[model samples]
Target: MTAKTLFEKIWDAHVVAAESTDTPAILYVDLHLVHEVTSPQAFTELRERGLKLRRPERMLATLDHSTPTLPTAANGERPYANDEAKAQVAQLESNCREFGVALHGWDSADRGIVHVIGPELGVTQPGMTIVCGDSHTSTHGAFGALAFGIGTTEVGHVMATQCLLQRRPKTLAIHVDGQLPQGVGAKDLILHIIGQIGVDGGTGHVIEYRGPAIAALSMEQRMTVCNMSIEAGARAGLIAPDETTFAWLQGRPQAPQGAAWDAAVARWRRLPTDAGARFDREVRIDATAVKPTVTYGTHPGMAIAMDAPVPPARNAQEKRALEYMQSQPGQPMQGMPVDVVFIGSCTNSRLSDLREAANVLRGRRVASRVRMLVVPGSEAVRRDAEREGLHQVFTAAGAEWRVPGCSMCIAMNGDLAQPGQLVVSTSNRNFEGRQGKGARTVLASPATAAASAVAGSIADPRDYLVEVAA
Candidate 1:
C-alpha cells in the first residue's frame, strides 16, 4: 500500500462503499452522540418518517446546552427555568426512552457535556468515525477518532443508517516544535495557531496536529487542542493515538476488554502519518514562541498577549470588535476591569484544566468586584474534583463552583454574563453575543481565567502562579 496521511488512513478504514471520486462515500459511524438542542429535530424527523433507529446501541444522548448550572432542586435534578429549555431536555428524554437509546441526563452520574463524557466513558476510541450534532464534536479526535459535527438532516441520516455520505476532506498537517514555555498551554497554543492562520485558513481541510510538542501533551491537553479545530474552519482535527491515548482508555467503561484492547492498541500504533506522506497544506509553529494568550476581539483569531495592549484595529471587523468590547486600541487589557470570569467549557473543563486553575486559586480569593464561576465539564468531573478537594479551593476563593454542563459557554440557558459586561472565559468561541447580548468575551486558559478572577481584570497566570509559589 502507498504511504498515506493519518486522515486518509482513518477515513479509508471506515469507508463502507465508494463509487467515484466526485460523489460522497458511505462512511460507517462507530459512535453517534446526540444532545437536546440539535437532536430534537433529528428525532422528530425520524418519528415523522416512521423510522426506528437503525442501531440504538450505537447512539448516546446527553443534556448539557440547556441544563442549568444552578440546580433547582436537591440531588442534582433541576428543570431548566426557561420553558423552551425545559422542553428540549424533556423532549430528549422522551425520544431516548422511545427509541431505546441510552441517555446521560443531568440525573445520571455519567452526565455532562457530550464530548466530555464520551472519552471518560471509554466510548471514544481510535480508528473510529464519531459524529455529534454539536460543532465541538471535533473534540473526540483527541482519541484518534475521526470525529466531526453533523447537521439535523445528517443527524437523521446517521440514525437510520449509521453511515454518512461524505466527500473526502483535504489534509493539512500542523507541526509544533520544542517544549511549551511555562504558563503556555493547549488553549494558548491553539489560539496562536488561529491568529496565525486566520479564521478561514483551515477551510475544506481536516487538520492533523503532529510533531513533538503535540506528542508531549497529555490526553486532556490534546483534547483541548482538537476541540477548537472548528474555530479554524476545519471539519475536524485529530492526533494519532499513542501511549498517552492508550493509557487514558485502558480501563474506561466502554473500552474494549482485555485481548480486544490489546488488538486495538496494535492497530492504533500503526495509524500515524506514514513516512513521506503528502498533505495539501502544512504549518509549523514553535511551542516556545507561544505565550499566555487572550482574545481582544469578537473572534478567536483577534488575540494578543495576555498583558499586552490590544493591537491597533487592522480591519473593519477588528474596529467593530473594539467598539463592542468597549476597549480602545493600544490599551492594555491587563488592568482592564473584568465583570465576570468563566472557567469551564469543553475546551478546557477537564480535570487537568481544573487542577491548573485550582493551583492558581489555592490560597487566593476572587476579586470582590468580579463574579467567578468554576463549572466542571461533567458530573464525573465534578465528582472527582470534589473528592480531590478542587471544589473547595474554587469556593474558598470566592468563586461559585457549579454543577456540570456547558454553562455560560453559550447562552442557550440563562448562565450568561450580563450585557456589556467583560467576561474572561475558558470556552472556545469568543464571538459577539456568544455569552449574552452585548457581552464582550475574552478567551483564555483555565489558569488565566482563575488569575483574572483574583485580579478582577485580565491578569496573567504566570505572575499569580509565581505569587502562589512565593
Candidate 2:
C-alpha cells in the first residue's frame, strides 16, 4: 500500500465516476450545508427542472447571511428592514419545506451561521465530504473532512444529485512548529500564515495544517484556523482528527451514539496522513514567533504584527490598499482611533472566542466614542454565554449583545459599519467595502477587538490580559 496525503485519501474515497485523474470526477457528498443568501436561486433551478432532492437527510439549511442580528419580532420573523432580505429568508423556509429538508430557520434555537451550527450539531464529521454555497464552507475541514464551497449552479447540482463534479487539487502542507506564545491565538497564527504565503500562495492546492502547534489547538480553535482557508486562496484547509476532535463530537445530538460512536472514533483515528505522505508544496512557520496580528490594509494578506510598523508597499495593489485605508508606511496600527468594534463571524464567534473577549471586557467600558457589538455565532453559543453571564459582562462594559447571525461580517442585512467609520472587527474579510461602503475595516482576533473597543483605538490584547499565576 502507498502512503497517501489526507486530501488524496478522502478524495479517492468519494470518487464515484471519473474519466481521468486530471479530468472531472463525480464525487459523493456526505453533507450539504445551505444558507438563504445562495440557496434561493439554486432552489429555483431545482424547481424549474422539477427535480426532487436526492438525499434530504444529508442537507442542512439555515438562514444566516441575510439574517438580522437583532431579536426577531413577536411573530418570530427576522426583523429585517429591507423587503428583499425578508423575502429571501422566507423563500428558504418555503423551499426547505417543499423539498422535505430539515431547516434551522430564523429564530430557531438551532439557528445560526450555517458553518458554526454544522459542527455544533455534529453534522460535520471526519473523512466526509461537505459542501456549502457560501465560501467559508471550508471550515468543516478542520474535522478531517474534505469540505469546499460551490456556486449556485453547483448548489443546484448537489441538490438534484447529492454529488458534485470536481478536479482533484494538489496538496500543500502548512507546518506550524513550536508552541504559541501568550496572547497569540489561532486567529493570529492563521493571519501570519496568510501573510507569509500571500493571498494567492495556495491558489491551486488544498492545505493540510500540521506540526505541534496545530495539534495543540482546541476543536473550536482549529475550526477558527481552517475557517479562513478561502481567504488564502486555498480550496480547503484540513486538520487531522485526534482525541480533541472525538471529545468535541462525542455527545452532540447528531453524533454517533454507543457502539457506533466507538466504531466511528476508531475509523477517524486512521484518517491522519501517513508518516511518509508527500505534498506538492510545503511551508513551515515557527509558531512561537507569531505575534498578535492585525490586518492594516484591505486584504487579509496585508497583515502585520500588532506593534510592528506597516512595511513599504511591494506593488501597486499594496500601495492602493494602504491608500484606501488612509494609512502610511512605517506607521504602527496601534493608536488609530476606531469608530466601531464588531465581534462576531463564523471565523471567531465560538464560545471560546466570546469568553476570551469577555475576560478582557469585565469591568471595562467601551470608549464613549465607539459603538461596539458582539453577536454570537449560534443560539447555542448565545445560550451558553448567557448561562455564564457573558451577556451581562458585555452589556455592562457598554457593548451591545445581539442574537446569533452572520452580522457585520459583510455589509449586508442592515448591520454595517457606517461610511468613513473605522471598525476593528473579528470578521474575516477586510476587502474594500466588505463591512460597508467607504468603511475602513481592520481585522483582528476577538480579544484584540474587545480591547480596542475599550481603548477606542487599535490596541494589542496582551496589554489587557489579566495574568493568572500558574
Candidate 3:
C-alpha cells in the first residue's frame, strides 16, 4: 500500500472495518440528505423491506427540483404545470414524515437545493461524512468532509443502515498555484482544469484541492471547485478545513457549540495531509494561465479560453463531441450567439456569486435578444439577496428574478430552455440534455454569464468589468 494522502487517512478513519473485497464495508455516515428526485424510489424500497431510517436526526429532506417556481398562495397550492413534479414533492414530504426525517419543503424558508441547503443551514460540517442521491454532493467536501453522491439503491442502504459499503478510492492531489487573473473565478478555474484533464481523468479517485490558489479561495469558492469534481469523475473533492472553514461553521445550527466547538475546530485543523504524504496521482495547474473559460462541446472538458478559437481534436471522440455540439474547430468562442443566460445552481448560487453578477449588470441592460434568469440556490440565499438589493439590479437589467429553486440548472422543474436554444449558464454540468432536451448549454462563470447576457454572445467579463471600472 502507498503512503496515504489526507483523503485516504480520512476514508480509513470512517471505515467501520471491511468485510472482504467483494463484501460491502460498513462506513459511517455523519449526514444523510435526500431530495425529491431520487428519494421516492429509495423510500419505496425502505417500505418494502420494512426498514426504518437508522438515524432520523442525521438525515434531512428538501423539495427543490420538483417544487414549482411559482409563489404559493395562502391556500398552499403552487402553480405547477406538471402534476407529477408536485406529486414527487408530496411523496418526499410524506416519506420524511413517515421516517421521522427532518424536511425543508416549499413552505419552509430553509428549503432550497440539497447541496446548497446543507452548507447554508450548518447541516454540513467538517470531519463528517455526507451522502445524498445527487452527484453534486461533493459540494459538502469543501468543508473538508467526506461527501459523495449515492445511487437510489445506495440511498436505500443509507436510509436503512446509516452506513455504506464503500470501496476506498485512491487519492489525487490537484495543486493550483498563483493568483487568478481578473474576472476569473472558481467556476472558470474548475472548467479550465476539467478541460485540461478531460472529464474522465479522475475516475475511481478522491481529489484533494491544494496549493496557494486553493488556499486563497473563500469557502463558497471552494465549494464551487469541489462541486464539479463529480463532473471529472472523482468520487469526491476536498480542501483541508482551515480557519475560513471553521469561521463559516461557527454559530451554524448543526455545528458544535461551546467546548465541543473549540474541540472540533482543533481536530479539523489537524486534518490536512501530513508533510510528504503521497497521492496515487497528482496534477498541477497554474492559476495565472486560466482565463475566462467556456464549454464548446457537451462535456465539461470540451472547453477553451473565451478569446481563443477551439482547437482541432485529432481523435475520433473529440471530432464526435465537436460535431454533436455543432461547433467547428478553430472557431472562436467569442461572438458566438446565445439565446439564454442562467446564473445559479449548487455551483455558483451563493451570495458572492449573485453579487458578482449584479456588479456586472448594474447600470447596463441585458441584450434585447437574450433571456436571462437568476435563481438563488436556496430560499435563504434568495431572501438574503433581496435584502441586499441584488434582486433589484437583476430585474432592472431585464433579468428575471424568480423564487428560490433549481430553476433552469436542470429540467427537473418546469423551468428549462426551448429546444435547440444555446445557453451560457453557471451550472456545473453541460452533459447532453442536462438543461433540457436538445438544449445546448455552455458552462461559464457568473460574471461571464452576465457579460454574455449583456452582449447576446460569449463575451468575457474582463471586458465589461474593465469598462465599468474605468
> Highest lDDT among the candidates is held by which one?
2
What TM-score, computed on C-alpha atoms, does each candidate reach? 0.98, 0.98, 0.97
* Tens digit of per-residue lDDT, candidate 1, span 1-470: 89998888898888899838677899999999999988888888889999999999999899889988886677655657588888888999999999999999856899999999999999999988999988899999998888999999999999999999999899989999888998789999999889888888889999999999999999999999999999999999999998899999999999999899899899889998899999999999889999999888899888777767788888787789899988777787777789999988999898999999999999898999999988899989988999999999999999999988899999777899888999999999989999998899999999889999999988889998887777
In candidate 3, position 329 carries an lDDT of: 82
- The residue pairs found clashing in candidate 1 are none
Model 3 lDDT vs. the true structure?
0.88
Q: Candidate 3 on 1-470: residue-level lDDT in tens?
A: 45556686677778887758678678989899999988899999989988888898999888877666667778977877588887887888888888898899866889988899999888898878999999999999999899999999999989888899887788889999998987899999999999988889889999999999999999999999999999999999999888899899899887889999999888887788888888889999999999999999888988789888888877887787677667778888888889999998889999999999999999999999999999998888998999999999999999998777777888778788887888999998788888889888999999999999999998989999999889
What ranges in model 3 sit over 4 Å off?
Answer: 1-4, 73-76
The model with the greater lDDT, 1 or 3, is: 1
Kindly indicate the candidate among 1 and 2 with the higher lDDT: 2
Clashing pairs in 3: none
Of candidates 3 and 1, the better by TM-score: 1
How does residue 61 of candidate 1 score in lDDT?
Answer: 90
Clashes of each: 0, 0, 0
